[model samples]
Target: MAKVRRYSSPYLSDIAGGKVVVSCQRCGLERRYDSAAMIERAGDVSLPELRIMIARAEGCPRADNVYRDRCELGYDPECWNGTRPKPTDVP
Candidate 1:
């Protein structure tokens, strides 16, 4: 049998029942992405991959950091600091 590798982050398709938003905590950059459209476009990319993609797309200086100071880009609320609710989650 071939060895299988598992990733700790969720694939884009694994996110469910909520709006998908990517944001940068340090610079206050943010974007709301349609999850279904994203899944169709990227074909189930892992959230970590998507985070880097977003950071690069937005020209974040820390996009390529591979050490302790990683880019702050992440899926909203859940992956990021959860103090604020995702915009869609607000009534």
Candidate 2:
């Protein structure tokens, strides 16, 4: 398995919905994947692979989208530290 990332649906908590933005590596293309909208298939495919599958289905075989963002947790820019803040941290 690849490095587990907090932003991917496979590793994120189900209770707190999150969103993932996929930016293509070949041609500049961005797609948002929300926790609520993702359909999990019965297989061993990882989230990154799934992302590549999505990219391929969309007519791009490069399937190398590196731009991913974790939007539901400590990523808020309004945090006092000018960075993502934890739940207990001041925002």
Q: Per-residue lDDT for 50 in model 1?
A: 81
Give the per-residue lDDT digits (tens) of candidate 1, residues 1-91. 9533367667776664445688777999878776778777776787888888878888988999999788878766463334567666789
- Give the top-scoring candidate (lDDT): 1
Question: What local lDDT score does residue 46 receive in model 2, on the 0 to 100 scale?
Answer: 49
List the RMSD of every prediction in angstroms.
4.7, 10.5
Q: State how far residue 19 of model 2 sits from its true place (Å).
A: 0.8
The models' CA-based lDDT, in order, is 0.73, 0.45
The clash number for model 1 is 0
lDDT of 2 by residue, 7-83 (tens): 44543233124554455444656555544455443133445555566666667644454555322111122232324
By summed lDDT, which 10 consecutive residues of candidate 1 come out lowest? 75-84
